[model samples]
Target: MLKGRPLQYFGTCIALLNMLGMGWPSPFLPVLERDPLTSITKDEGSWIATTYLIAGPVGSIIAGIALNKIGRKRSLLLSALPFLTSWIIIAITQRLGFLLLARFIAGIGGGAIYSVLPIYISELVDPPIRGFLISVMGTLTIVASLFINILGYYVNITYSSLICTLPSVVFLLFFPFIPETPNYYIVNGKIDVARKVLSQVRGRQIDAEEIQELVESNEKGLAKAGVLDLFKIASNRKGLFVCLGTMGAQQLAGIVPIIFYTQTIFEKAAADFPVIASTSLLYVLLIVFSAVSSAIVDRLGRRPLLITSISCCCVALLMEGVNLYLKSQGGLNSIGLSWMTLGDLSFLVIGYSIGLLVLPSVFLSELFPLNVKGLAVGFCNIYFSVVAAAVSKLFQITSDHYGLHVPFFVFSASSFLSLVFAVIVVPETKNKSLEQIQIDLRNKDEHNKGEQTHLLKKYCSEQ
Candidate 1:
């Protein structure tokens, strides 16, 4: 037992709860659609996913304001309430209308939790261990996702739906034990409380001078910031673009469609196989692989991991596209023992687990400065949610109109573009301080413009 470090344990527990609650509902989408209570058409089924993604961005934007005003502990407890209620409603109602509404509400809670946790962790933990701790959140979510998919495979629909409620219940019960973020306390001028929380979380008495320095630094940063000030900073703009591009690339990598509609895709393509069982097994395996990838992300550095991951994703997606194209051409229909299809699907999952599935959150946390971190993360999440909604709808529409290969081809092209963007625009931020990153980006931008200016000056002087 790490004495006096209740906050660390509490944070891990909260993260685990949030992940379990949010991720478990995901694998149930296919099963829900198949149930009599929610016999949705393919388009309508996609809307359920769309609703969650749309709600995530909206909820993320609201989270900062809510946390600033209401306080972190209170906000988290309040957020979990909706998920619990939503699960109960889902278990009983069985109406498509009610189901959508419930999912949207649950999504709001989940989104808020996701948007806020990184900021809270950054503020609370020491720098050396922060990456490891934050990565634990991703690991736990993947674990929960794997567990839930397995449960959904064997359990009855009603039971599976009911099982999603456990995390929220656990969250609400345990939330009271965690302390409010020390930064949030400082922001509100509760110095005594902030000091106490910091001491407890750090498992040692923080030097008063150090705490005062932090408070002073925070005050100066806050004083200089205005609503539009983030736009005026070149570093902020660069960071924002990187954040947005990274998030967009993560979604555009096509993992969302694969995770949410795995059973559907399997059924549509490999109807002869045990679709549900195979998909469930693959999801569980991918989650395990994703956790392993996340553990090594910090060591590999952001840029190499991102470039490598996106490259692998592009290749995998292209392979999937080629497979789909072949099937469309009736080349595989005659072959009764086509292990090639299975191999291709495994490649897709492996590519995703190794690359796109693991890096977005890690990149986001590393790239942004603390001053505008919360709002910047919130905005990035907004892009993610919007792209997810659009992609989910696009996958359904494209699959119906142009055949399944079209969507995979589109996703592969986007991944290729993302690889180019990563190489040219994204910086390697391994083991670097946030302030150092800001300086590097600003210098890079100045150097690029300086070269252009010199060329213009030479021409003008000659003319």
Candidate 2:
């Protein structure tokens, strides 16, 4: 019961930098490949697109080691530095080497933020609005992408990259004022301090007994666990698989390629709108739909929304493939379905924003306890970076070798698989307390314990 809800907005302000840096290169990538100012080959462009992802594991690894030691707020500040530095590099140098390194550096920073920020958000907010706050993160990301696209639309590459540094700077400056989450204090055994912070965030005094209950509940469950040990426990293992699946499905859904290659796709689709306008509209649709999805998440519950989302994604990808295939046949203008490609692109965002886009972050935030939170999230982001890099690099190669429709069709298949996985693996987390989530995870022995107790009582009675 946060009396002041601005805490969520503050979290979004800091986390927005990662996506801003991530989306900055999107609009400018097409220009970098063919513009006379900084003409690079397709191979170089692909490498540049992947360089950030390739470098992400470094940030995640470092964040895993230092996250708790340095604390969440400080760790987030460190993440901002790389984003700011990378944009500065981009602004100062157009040299291919410099640009590549900059993207990679930015990825390192983005990785740190991606790995740590969701955990921060999850711990900061309560369960009911947890989905909503996380949804705001995705919505802000779309908004940032739109902002960067607008910059690319109006300005030169150097100036636009320079302008990108501003938000990161603001985040770095403002984030330190925000307090660390209560979980961080609890994990450190500072129960009094944890209570104070929680009280502050809620803008009212929390009951000491409530904090004591939370500690007792999570003490054994959240004991100091390492990354590899995450698999040793049944509950932790299941949670790991869910996080991995969520990350894997997100990348395979082809969102990364869509961001990196939006201009290329628009050019090929012969889209009805200008490239800038179309990209802007895509972001707007994503933001609007993600906001709506967030609003409905708690009410509708997690599983149903996720099922509907991936189902729509499969259809969206299928239609996108068909649109590309038909357009390749060269009679789409006469048939007047060129608009269908745009519709598919729109639905891709709309569908994912509804479930796929934001829920994965929420999943990671809730799945692991404080002890393994950093490392577990790091592992997920590491996998995410690998998948992101592979998809982005292979997009051009696959499209060149097998045609654009093939990639879209492949993505469709992946989305369908993910839909099945969601049905089997994803539990409804909405409205459940974090402690309850852990209790549910460890409930497999309830019947066995009950039976044993009954057997013991009968034996004693016979005796």
Candidate 3:
């Protein structure tokens, strides 16, 4: 177990590094477009982000198949190489064509990392610590994003692009320290090796009974679910709905617009504020809040935090819309009120950081069974990427015609709807085993129908 601790930590670190590589360049894309070598139009620049997400769904599907065959350790190592090459290309290349290709390739790496890492983490840790560890990946990614945004705000673009390479290097260094997941070994029919790997990750010498149970549980799960059988289950239906809903919520939470077009949002909000610097500082502060939220996720549980945080987001978005409405009406006469606008925007950022951004990935990871984990996550990501693309384009259009406030209003409504869906439909998965979760969802579905049947019989008898 002691030997395995290093490997678990190594996996966690690799997940963090993946997020850093994926997220760091996003906030500074405007600067990238503005560079003389590229000199892209605003619409074309937005496509860069769109293209990255376009690859995400496809990459995630590939990663699911690849991880099962190649194993977690090798898949992670291979994913890092593309990220390294992408950074180098962006740093050296003057051609727009090459730069787009590099970004697309980087997106593939990012998408795969996002899809596969959760499954890897799930396979590595015990049920108790799984949520906390998986949630940390997102927390760390936000932190890296915050750090890079600050750098881009203050440093030159060339330096910022170069600095993005460091995390990939860090990942490559740590790759050899982690072991393949026990589940992966079990699937490959290496029972003894699987047990050894399990003992290491659990940080205690697992008993032969426990190892036997794990093997049996995995085999039973596989027996119940053939490779192509995930599509047939009622539980899978709920899982798909939850995955798609959460992914849609995540993108429509107005996060991508904030991350990719921070300067633009700030420009609309605070005309006199230094757009780049202020937006960077805001991202840093919000990221700090996201880290704090991650630490509390397990303690508070998923549902309550999701509800509260998303509700807070709705309020913040409304506040921003109101601020914009007031400004449009020539109502910002006081300096005090002007400063309050920044405060309002910060509230929106913090609310989103705490709720929508951090929880969706954690929830989706817990929602799916192993049989379809990869493909389910990949489909969710496809929706995420598609919405991200749509939102980016929508932001540009709304800002051009209706004003910045229109986008905020749209997001505010979407978040409110998400909160409703979460409360009514999403189950609490905190600390539950995957098998247990599947059973609960099935039972819940059964219970609902039983209640309906009872109500119908009672009404008919009464009539």
Q: Put down candidate 1 lDDT per residue, 144-249, tens digits, no spaces.
A: 6777667766776577768878887877777677777787777778888888888888888888897897687565334434446457777778888887888788
| Model 2 CA deviation exceeding 4 Å by range | 1-21, 34-37, 329-337, 444-463
- What count of clashes does model 3 give? 0
Candidates' lDDT values, in order?
A: 0.72, 0.81, 0.74
Q: By the TM-score metric, which is better: model 1 or model 3? A: 3
- Please name the candidate that would achieve the greatest lDDT relative to the true structure: 2
Q: Per-residue CA lDDT of candidate 3, range 1-463, in tens?
A: 2466566766676656766876645545666567786687777777766777777777777787786678877777778877888778877773668767877888888788887788788777766767777777766776777777677677776677788889888878876677788877777788899887777787778888988877675554544344455467777788888778776777777867756766666565554666655666677767677777777877778888778878888887888777777777778744544566677777877877776777778877777666667667777777777788788788778977998778888988998998898898777888888667877877887998899999999999999
lDDT of 2 by residue, 90-123 (tens): 8888778998999889889878988888888777
Model 1 bad stretches (over 4 Å): 1-10, 24-39, 216-220, 224-227, 333-338, 435-463
Worst-scoring 10-residue span by lDDT in model 2: 1-10
For each candidate, C-alpha RMSD in Å? 3.0, 4.0, 2.7
Return whichever of 1 and 2 wins on lDDT. Answer: 2
